[model samples]
Target: MNRLRILLADDHPVVLAGIRALVEAEPDMEVIATAADGTAAFDLADRLRPDVAVLDMSMPGPNGAEVAERIARYCAQCRVVMLTVHEDRAYVRRLLEVGVAGYVLKRSAPAELVRAIRAVAAGGLHLDPAVAALAICRDPPRPAAPEAAAEPTEREAEVLRLTAAGHGNKAIAQALGIAVKTVEAHKANGMGKLGFRSRVELVRYAASRGWLGSLQP
Candidate 1:
């Protein structure tokens, strides 16, 4: 099998070294390049288009979210993961909107970073257990709770839960082993059944149901 190429960016030298050490120690992973700030991160990732870009949330120039946006625009296939000290839901929402595939906390980096890299690289979402619970709370699209007359099936609930947690349609499809179109279908059906008119409403409902913490796969 081929090795997984990773590009990492963090401002701190020691932390960068530590992460690099952890990644390079893996037999199937390789660190192709490292950057000290978001600008360097963006430049390296955009050019190299590594399988995954592991970035610090607060770098000097662009920041992790900004770098993720640029990478997604230029190197669409390169997955992005954030190593952040901030567990704020706002940050998660911003980066998720930019197509970040993984969100891992700095506190859990030693134990979780490798798994996060692999998961995102393989087109799946990986949220640190603690971060997953507090990171991003999707604003419910509707004001009131869903009308009791209709409810979603198990698959539909699964789709909405992941969607509310900020996975895009394609990511959700990959995670659930379904087609992108199928994800769209499930999301639409679930939304209609629950009186959720938009992504915002679905998110709110999921949050209300505490579905974000369901980080299965």
Candidate 2:
């Protein structure tokens, strides 16, 4: 069987060791490298191209957001999972904008991190349940002009919500008991009505409206 290659980065030695042990204990996952700073993390990721890069939000050199952005640009094939202490919505929004696939809190159970790694490795997004609530309490989105665009219909809203929650078209279709083409149509109409051009924008909008509170890993 092909093992999932992982790269871990955290400045704390004991914490790093603990995380390494947790990941190494998984029979299907392997830690190929570890780093104490963001720069080294990016360097290792770019060089080794691990299946997933688990990073701490706060680190010396470039920081998690910067490293995530760089890796997204230069190492598109590698997925990023942020293992962080930060529960702030601002941090979550910024990381999502830069293409981080998973956001797991350091305070969460050890199994949460493993689940995050597995989710992102399988092309899914994982947000810790603790932080997911913050998405609902965030400040509302900035107002758009009255004539700018119409609001999304109820069906469109449903599609956008699930999309923002990181479900793909087929999954959304299955969950909603709709056809894939209809799911795509609803997604397109919702994004068009809201003037959203990207999934990041849709997610940010969802966060502002507290529509992401129901998300699960």
Candidate 3:
């Protein structure tokens, strides 16, 4: 059986160590690298292209979303799951907007983290139930579309494609000959329509839909 290759990213060494123990305990999964911040996470991910990346939402130089975005761009098959203490829907929304596939709270059991990793690796979305319930009750703003979650507008689609490709807003605008604000608007719309709660979800959805293939170098 092929072992699951994983990368761990967290600002806290203790937490990172704990996660490593939990993940590596599984015979089918192994930790190939560990990072203390977002930049390191991206570097390791780019170099190793692990099957799954477990990341802390708050980290130095790029944050979890940025790391996930970069991974999605360079390692299309890699799955990113945010391990965070944050329960805010806005934060979750941003992660989903970028196409991350999993969100596990830090307080959750190690088993939950394992579950999230397995789910994401299988191309499914996973969210801590507590966080998801809170989001459902508040009725947050929507992006992209409603019924059928129809394709975004041409510009919005372009932005989504670029976003999935790991391009920053400024970069996307420059490449697409649009204003930065316009790029933001389209990106927002794309996320809203998809009802993504975070950048992670957005990236996953775009990838699953094959939107990023066109943007690959």
Q: Estimate each model's TM-score.
A: 0.70, 0.72, 0.66
Question: Per the 3 Å backbone cut-off, how many clashing residue pairs does candidate 1 have?
Answer: 3
- Of candidates 3 and 1, the better by lDDT: 1
The local distance difference test score of each candidate is 0.77, 0.82, 0.76
What RMSD, rounded to one decimal, does every model reach? 4.9, 6.2, 8.3
Which segments of model 2 are wrong by more than 4 Å? 136-193, 197-200, 204-214
Per-residue lDDT of candidate 3, residues 159-179 (tens digit): 876665445576567678989
Tens-digit per-residue lDDT, 1-217, candidate 2: 8999999999999999999999999999999999999999999998999999999989999999999888877786688899888888878878876778789999999999998888777756678888865543354444544554788999999888766655556656777899989998998888877767766667767766767443441
Best by the TM-score measure = 2
lDDT of 1 by residue, 1-217 (tens): 7999999999999999999999999999999999999888988887887998899998999888888878866776688889998877777667666767788988874768888888777656677777565433433244434354667899999988776654667667777899989998998888778776554455446655766443442
Clashing pairs in 1: 140-204, 141-200, 141-201
How far does residue 155 in candidate 2 sit from its true spot (Å)? 18
> Top model by lDDT, which number?
2
Model 3: worst 10 consecutive residues (lDDT sum): 208-217
